[model samples]
Target: MAGTNVLFTVIVILIYNAYTIDSISTANLEASLDEYINAGLKCHTKNPGLALAIVKDGKVILTKGYGVRDLSTNSPVTDRTIFGIASMSKAFASTLLVKLLAKHSNMSIYTDIAKILPNFKFTTHIRTDNANIRDLLSHTMGFPAHNLMRLDPKLTRDDIASRSQQVHSIHPFRDSYLYNNLMYGLASVVAERIGGKRWEDLIEEELYTPLGMSGSSFMTKVDLSGNVAKGYGTDDATGGPVPIDFAINRRWGQMGGSTNIMSNAVDISKWMLFHLSKGRNQAGQQILSENDMATLHRRRNTITAPTSEKYFSQPQVPVSSLEENYALGWKNGVYRGYKVLRHTGTTWGYSSLVTLIPDMNLGFFTTMTGDDPGYKFRYLLHNYIGDLLLGETPWLNKTTLCSFPEPWYNQSTSVYHPINKHINPTRSLNYYVGVYHNSMYGNLHVTMNTSANTLQMNYGIGSWLLYPKGTHDKFVGEGTNIVHKIIDLSSIQFHSSNLHGRSTIDSVKVISFETRAPPVFTKTSSHVNTGNIVG
Candidate 1:
């Protein structure tokens, strides 16, 4: 009896020891996830309008909302709040393309886009007779990143497709991966043609619905019924949050293959799980085939050069690397010793980042409804979460790196001014009234169209307008800060030059303008008795 009692005591002790070890392990994991959340919140406090989520092994280890959804009303953010995932929509849309390929075994990414859109052509640009569909997905078709398309608010996917034919490639096809949103917009058109439905509808039917992402939608104008994070932008002058109201248009929405999708962290976690499972849903339904999944995550291009001189300071290889490899919609690279698959999205007001470390089965999604200030919070959170997952201490400074000095979290009261309202008067109809000459662009004529109240500066196939800024000078029609204050007419100084024909007064050059001269003889020749012909 004494020996049997001693045996029972030994068994109880072993079981208790096992239970304690399991408890410690669970606690450690929870602590790690907590540290990530705390670091994310700290970053959010600095930028005030960010939503973040972290997932590991198909489970949302940490998900939290920080700051207010609407800075104006001071409404707190919630887990279910919707955010514009921006270009992350491309990842989702790309997943649908992969799924379609899996369902139809014969479909190929290498298939000529012209197969779906017969009128599609790259015959005009790069001397190429045609471009492949993969070029559009990989962003190597050589179209300009973005141009006049943004100005035409009515541009559609088909319009973008037709315009792509006129785009000139700087290099041969597949020579380099040049990120182009316009090209992606054109790709969406191909998807529409092949799927026989809108890109949004395809995503809903195949990806979102199957994955049970009920809160996910491709709608730009989000329904206000549930918690919705209002989009914000930093005022260029004041460095404060400015609320932006964007209208949902088909052109923008169909750009879903590139940007334009709204989702909550909860729904996005499901997306992470789907990717982690290699395109399998929660119910074990294979949403995409293994081959398609492999193709989407494969390295398609090699980084031959730094993305920019500034990017050299960072350790990760730029998306410019790899060749013939396509990773569906995600750009695959290594960052900070980890295999990173990431993409960034931006609209006028919102910014989003989605990063996945496939080797570790870890994924992160961060959404900021505001501008650059908000993105600072995102970077901090991303790094901190990464550190926690790797069992390292979080390291991020609280100070903002914004160009301006101001409270990073403060909201801006600056009003939005229309492009027409800010035009300078001197540059309106009178400044460009005379003829001008340039060494490179050649002879030019500035005409004032009084009926239109616009100054037309004609050059080649393109023309720019100098709208009135104040009473003295005009502002360029399409100028961001990067291209702003180009050719300040207020500083123009008149000088006489004898080199060109008779002595003609020339305006002093302020900012460099690159444009060709208008046609010399639009109207018939008029010869005057002064021995001068003005046509």
Candidate 2:
């Protein structure tokens, strides 16, 4: 018996030694990733925080948090700390659509959207007649991010989709690729119609519970408590981020199925793992058939060539970098000879990224709370990880950081636009104070701030102070708006003292304004007159 015991002990020691050696190799790989991620994040000292998770072989292998989640409490971010995942929510909606399509043999990904939602007719039909569920998911329906409609929580998904007719398509349907949120909202309405429930309810029942993503939520019942990270924005002048308030945060609920999903890295890893498993839930249930999975992952629309000379003039990713296309809910591209699936989401104070390399059996999820004007750090970190995992050369270094665009406002220029600092208002500030209306967007109310001596403008989920730009009827405004982008307007004008002007982003005019009668608030006055006010 004693001899047998000694032999057993020896065998255990041998097994332990072998496991230790293997763990040592794994630890080195993890350490490399840690250093690489931290180094990439070091440049953004103003960033409120970040949470990251990496999955391999259907398991979470690396999970971490960096920086402060709340500056006031100096709390560190944790795996469970929630951040607004923004457009990443689209994948969940897409997955749900796939599930619904499978359950209802009558429906198909190629089913025309107009057939599903007859009410979703555009004012001037272009190729909308040919639009389908796949078109909405792939963003080939010919509309550029018309995000202004996503600011009013009061607007239902149907109301938002109805306004799609009011906006013109920048490209012919299926002729050009343009990112759109309204299309996703329209898709959700179609999903609701097919599923006989609210889009959020369908998502919660079909995706969240099945995947065990307890930390995820749609438009309602957001749990920002218990380790949830607060959203924040930066001021280039102060060189730090300030906590965002309800005025801007409210838009998260109004984005419909487009961008409103709040989740943490811990739960998000499950989502990545599900995709890595080719659309199988942990319970061994095939959430989507292999064919449907193929449909979801297959490239449905070829996007602009990344290497086209037209893109060379200030392109986000080099065309030669990767031949890319839009898969159902993922951006499909080639990275270092591997099929790369990825998506990015941005809100006013948070940014998120999810990447999957199915060939390597690896997946990654990261979310950051920052006001990065270009939101490049998320991608930089993503690229560095992809390079490291693929065993490529260290192409990203301190110098690589120089390629990122500067924050919209930087130290050299004034951060907070001082009221009338650059140019004084030619007329009294009160001249610009009035109610502006657009049929698509509910209202914009401008009022004279007596204390600040600036004209304050309030619209769906945002408020900004307009300062004179030294031009008659033209004013400049600078601030972050509700849809999570910076507002740098130079042509905000008041033609005929009625506050008529246009606001643009990326050189595309997205919103127009004009004076209208204020909301009549009389006692017992119901239906105080509303009309289709063309913006």
Candidate 3:
């Protein structure tokens, strides 16, 4: 029975695609949107659910939901269902900054971040004073992305900001672009300091309340009272989606500006319409000045073909023909002869995309329960809509550009068959069990799980058990923080031997790796000796 349904869905999708190519009327487009989205979602049959909204010419043309909210109950998702929009929250942060600037009058995007975050520091050689609000919005902060540090539930925004000096930069100040979550978090901190309110409350007061986006908020768990969709993650080995716990509220309090807002398609449509109307409320009152809105949309950084290829590989737009640029909090480029601005967000099991075409006055919002595959589905939906609206050829396919967490966990591990058997550690697990610290990220306590004969490293609020990677001294593991326990696992790699060639019995060297960044840690003067330790 399931097989028959799958075949039927495929056939329907093909027919709809053919119709969409020929259709030109807005009525026709609206009529086929449900089928179009359903067809795109067929590739992610195991995903828990999804909700989408399309806004055109200052009004919502379509808002719908697909699949079940949860696998166990089979509860269908509705237009009102809430899901974490992840980095989509960045635009909200950007908007808040613009709004604050309008009120302050004296402030500008060029205002030095030091004015807001007095304690922010950079490495000695770098000109920390040159850093300003614009750098944070355009992601030209010059520092590498250090997302792992932001995953700690215990660390406040101030804690992360104070340690900025500890994070090394790959590019010289304002010379290149690096997508950064910490910078966005810092932007919110600046807003809090200026607006005299929590980031969440400021958003509510300045934007959500006025726009009537009652369904949207930074409170992930509190949003559950509504019809919220359960998030799911794709298993790298099996390519199957499974339920992931929604622990977003715990860690998002401080990082809310980067990836914490929760909202439904219905509410997000209002946001889209607001942007389409150029930041005016329904009453025609200017909520944000037109000049400020334009500032938010102004291209601040140019993204070359190489960076696009490096970040989002296949299924992405050919970087050679089109130029991509980053604005304050949005990504803009030309698509099918129309000016396009879009951004994608991933938080644990949920993924989101918001695209705006100012020329056509069209906007799209999509949210789904899965990781990388969900991203694929989003791009598919965006392309399909774009093709129909722009009267272009159906260009996006299964191979569309998709992104996953760093240290991408794929099926590569399964390819190497065991030669003999798993190798054990050189010394007892206790030798690795110690508190290692990094100035920027704080302490990661490695403890011996005697019962399991394994070593577990705890970073702030989450912990993961380590296992031999290729060698016993070098270990690799995957786990999430205590807060959002979303199935999208953060990976970690550990090394015990001194890569620096300086190790003592009481103070062994340790290296910790997470996704794209690596931080080295050395044992403290004291060590916890478990009886299991052996030379």
Candidate 4:
């Protein structure tokens, strides 16, 4: 939520080594790909399963799977093996939205969200009130990533819509990209409001059914067919891959259009073909206009991270660096000088990377199971494939990427004190027990855990055990689990304010809620239902 997910700052830009299109024989292409991929699986990626699908010149060129689907079963991954593609599902949301817009003359991409869903609002900061569908699609809606909002129990699309008013807009409207998942869910809320249909049903009718993506469905239900791949993550203690629980374990039902779409390479190939053919159906009719498709694919928002010209101190890979920008669903940019649109997604135990070169009518979709925190394997293979197809010698490989150290995102950060474990609280635990509420964030409960003789913070996202930090009133939360894996739970600082006449702890700040501006929940009351606290 704070910075780039998986990106590498190459040392220097390389010259485009343009070779003849026929330089690599067609017969050798598949063999070469298999050899390279198999080597990658063995060398550094170490994924349990991976599926790849490629579309070119309006045809499905390749559908292949390698390795076992899960470590427990030893069942080999097939071309049809199902894997969860996380945020890549965003493209489907935006595409379905565009198709819906085609039927409704009253609604357009430029329409303000408030017009479609009257109750929807964003922080009353008038600057953010006028945000339209395009802003949501492109993630330029001004709100920084408020991921914790999605953790509410049995949250509906309406709840997400209602909560937008609470989250402050920290970024510029329609200028900088914020990459918000909740905003996408809020956009889907708008879609359902105007289309008079659930976002799931709308996509199934307009996109999936027509594209013949029979195996693709929302992640809420488990496929009884017994073909689903298990999710994974690396264990911090062992630094080895571990089988993580499903999204269901953490209430995936609350996720609307933001994420959780289960699909196989076969179904996703049809999806790729839809974009490659400019939204044409099998019947040779346009589902969406070429201009609309272009608009969806065109770069609308600029961002830092991989898109910005920044250098990190490390041994680097030689890649062609070019200016890049974010489009609606995909990151519209260049890979080795080829105009490209791409996106990568990672969930509990699955990761996916997709690339599309519209000029060449080429698209690549690769998804894998197991832990890939840095996603180096996916990026390495994406660039390698781009090199092979572009007729240039491949420069990216496992040795170059895997050699770098994986980032440690657990530690909390602050300029004054990263953490002062030596600090201790001066007051009794009972004084801190209360309900702190942020208008946009709703409420967080702090209650006495008499059994443990400690303070427990109850939020929709996590149940944190609070302990003193040496001498300061500020305490740190120990969170072993979270709504989503990536959220970093940090210091919980209690502020003293005047109540009647004497000073008391009146507000508590969750320092990790937002990196730039932490959500300070005021003490609404010291009374709360301890039974309502959940993990």
Whose lDDT is greatest here? 4
Candidate 3 residue-wise lDDT, 1-535, digit = tens: 9999999999996676545444566677776666666655665565568888888767777888888787778899888888888888888999999999888877999988877677667774444778888988888867767666655554676666666656777776778878888778778888888899888888999998999888776643355555777778655556677676555344664675888688899989988887878888766778998888999989999775422233334333432113388887788866666788788877777888888888667888888887753254566577667776656665543334221222232423334232222557656666667766676666667777666567766665556666655553666544534422232233344444454695432332233344445666656623544332211
Candidate 1 Cα outliers beyond 4 Å, as residue runs: 1-46, 125-130, 248-251, 303-326, 373-376, 397-474, 477-535
RMSD to truth, every model: 10.7, 9.5, 9.4, 7.7
Off by over 4 Å in 3: 1-27, 304-323, 393-421, 470-472, 478-517, 525-535
**In model 2, where do residues sit more than 4 Å from their true spots?**
1-24, 126-128, 305-323, 397-422, 428-431, 478-488, 497-535
lDDT ranking of the models:
4, 3, 2, 1
Q: Which prediction has the highest TM-score against the true structure?
A: 4
What lDDT score goes with residue 471 in model 2?
A: 71
- Model 4 lDDT tens row, 1-535: 2233222222121222223333556557778778778877775444778999877777787888988888888888888888888888889888878878888888888888878876666766464567889888887877787666555664666577777667777866766767888888877887787778887788788888888888887776656357887776754444456676564323553465677577899988888888888888656678778988987898888866752233221233356433368787888777666898888777767889888888777888899987664556776677777777777777754454444332312223323333333445678888999888888777799988777568878787567667787646778775535533333366678999786897788898887777667888999898887666655
Candidate 1 global TM-score: 0.70
Error of 3 at 12 (Å): 35
**TM-score of candidate 3 on Cα atoms, chains taken together:** 0.83
- Candidate 2 weakest ten by summed lDDT: 517-526
Query: Which residue pairs show collisions in model 4?
Result: 166-440, 231-349, 232-349, 422-470, 423-469, 423-470, 423-471, 424-470, 424-471
Residue 343 alpha-carbon offset, candidate 3, angstroms: 0.8
lDDT of 2 by residue, 1-535 (tens): 9999999999996675445323434577678766765665677765778998988767777778887788889899988887888888788778889989898778899898778777567654655577778888888877666554455555666576667666666667787777777777777878888999987788879888888888776534575566777777765456677676634445555545677678888788888888989888777777777887888889878877432222212244432235478887787877656788888787767888888988777788889987655446766676666665555555565545544433221324444644455567676765555555555665555666566678665555555667777876566555534422344444465555122463211111112321121121111211112232111
Q: Candidates 1 and 4: which is better by TM-score?
A: 4
Shift of residue 214 alpha carbon in model 1, Å: 0.5
